[model samples]
Target: MKNILQEVFETLRDFLSVNSPEQSHMLTVYANLDQANPLNRKERPAWLIELKNTFDNLSEEQKNALMTFDGASLTWNGIEEQIISTLEQHEAKGRSVVVFTDLSDTVVIDLPLPVKTGVYYGIPQVKHMLSQLHRYGQYLVVLFSEREHRTVFVDVPTLVSEGTLQSSLGEGIFLRPGGNKTRTQASERRNLDTERRMLREAAGEINDYFMDEPLFDRIVFGGNLKIAHGVKNNLHHAVAEQLVSIEPIPFDATDEQLRETVSILADEYEAVHDLALIQELILRGETCGRAASGMDEVMDALQNGQVRKLYLPYPMDADDFDTLLIEAVLENVEVELVHGIAAETLREMGGVGAALYYVIR
Candidate 1:
């Protein structure tokens, strides 16, 4: 349920806008509340109890806040509908209790994916979530048409309609006739021109998003092939360069159908993204001397905060891999989980590699 992570994410953005105390003697806690973990759901989670005990040593204001907060109440908010799988609450005196949930591990506190969690109010701790989630891959699926731009992130398909853009080229002239065939053909030409114009204008709007760092570097086309292709053809070079593939979904595709379409298209997009990253890593490693391959070199670079990017050929099951992942997050390093030939390439370099802060050249 992540209880609709997007809502939590949006709330976090709004909360960050105001200045709250760094350590306002506020009592903050992150309760996993994973249904599978009973301990987390109990009346008093051990973590919360321990935190409560710690507050007793602080000033009366902190103690009062912690004492008044019904820890179980926090866990049960939206729990009846199974809306919350993981819950995090940030509380302060004279401030409302703020909670965020996600269907996936959006925080590094519990997961090893370089995500971060902080109890301090007014701090944007979600930077870790924002940066790492996209690194794994977040696609900007552009469903192009003359009417509107239906953009979606592959991972979160339901929210596709949110950032959508709308535009119109006015109604196109319809062609019909025998004696007026010449006029009809001209009308047809005009209509197609209008269609093309609308598609390109939509593409330009989509391109504007990337320029502003939508952070979704990969693009997949959806909707009518004719219009989608036209948009692809006319896309600003920046957007065109990142076009991965086209999704087999019509503009009017239903939610269920779009979900299925996204599944297949997402797989293809990942392959494309991984291949592109691998090629870039190799070319840059050789040309710029900024990338390091092999475990020892990568770890050394990570320890020094020189690893601009990290490439793990495949998911490692060993302790060492976990250690590396932990170090990467602590250092705020960018990591990509690669597969297939990309994995093979990294394996050739001792199963790990890093793009560093400096180039030997």
Candidate 2:
């Protein structure tokens, strides 16, 4: 609603001209009232509560001229009296005042009117007020009765859209429209979730899967809410601890939102779980005349200093592997030593040899 009001104001300001039906400040006021009551609802006739601070600039005669049934007078004050009276009436109604003139020597009061919208009568006044407001470096406010029920306060120089601010105030969940590949993607997530659930429910399969694995890094379950939760619970029960983090990807999530969620999940998994997986190839254990073994086969890669990173047990003495560590450092390898509760739990799930970050390219 506030946004619609701002759009109207912007349109009015951008295209106001002599040919335009809305002219003269007084006419603008009437137009604003009509605009506020666009539907011409007889019951809700819009009222313009004009607050006038008539100083000596307006003689008693001119001041009287302003009182000709323009609208309901919210409050009127003598120049001698402080503007606080008008401010009070405005605050009572939760509305902001649109100061007509951009008086150069404007004063700032801590009156409760937090949001301000200021309007100069026309371009000359607008330019002058803008300059004067700039000199004072104070927030200027003016009110626009956009619709009968809505009033928007916009700062002159800043030209901030009140509606935009309101919209941005809350965390908005924008559901993206489904894409051509959405069904396929959703189906895959469902299948992966089902697989994890089945493995966990069948404890024998779960144990068999992990029995001979050297280490496992991270287990990611992606699916809808129900399947995701099922996989998560099953993995927890199977491993006697949480083995996977359940990331429920919404079917209608934007690419950017999905990317952000995936990044966050990856970071959490890396911090808490080891990205290593151990798989015992019972059916094809001896392949290419080599028996499956951990660390020993990869030892040459570790020695040649080709290892980019070493995920070692937290409690393992660095001194015992200092030579390999130095070689790794020389080869610019990152050695992450997994420790504490994460070490104990993730090791059972498959410890330090985990994928930290994945790059699509």
Candidate 2: tens digits of C-alpha lDDT, residues 1-361:
2222233234334333222222222211111122233342354422223222223345555444333323433222432233433333332321222332112122121111222232223222222111122210111111111111111222321232222112211322112233546467677677566555343443333334433332322233333444334434554354534244445544444535444554555445444444232222111223322222234433455554344345555555323343343333334444455445545643554333322222121
Candidate no. 1 TM-score: 0.55
- So what's the TM-score on candidate 2? 0.21
TM-score of every prediction relative to native:
0.55, 0.21
Candidate 1 stretches greater than 4 Å from native: 1-136, 144-153, 156-164, 168-180, 184-193, 209-217, 279-290, 303-306, 322-332, 357-361
Worst 10 residues of 2 by lDDT: 140-149
- CA lDDT of 274 in candidate 1? 79
Q: Per-prediction RMSD in angstroms?
A: 11.0, 28.0
* Number of the top lDDT candidate: 1
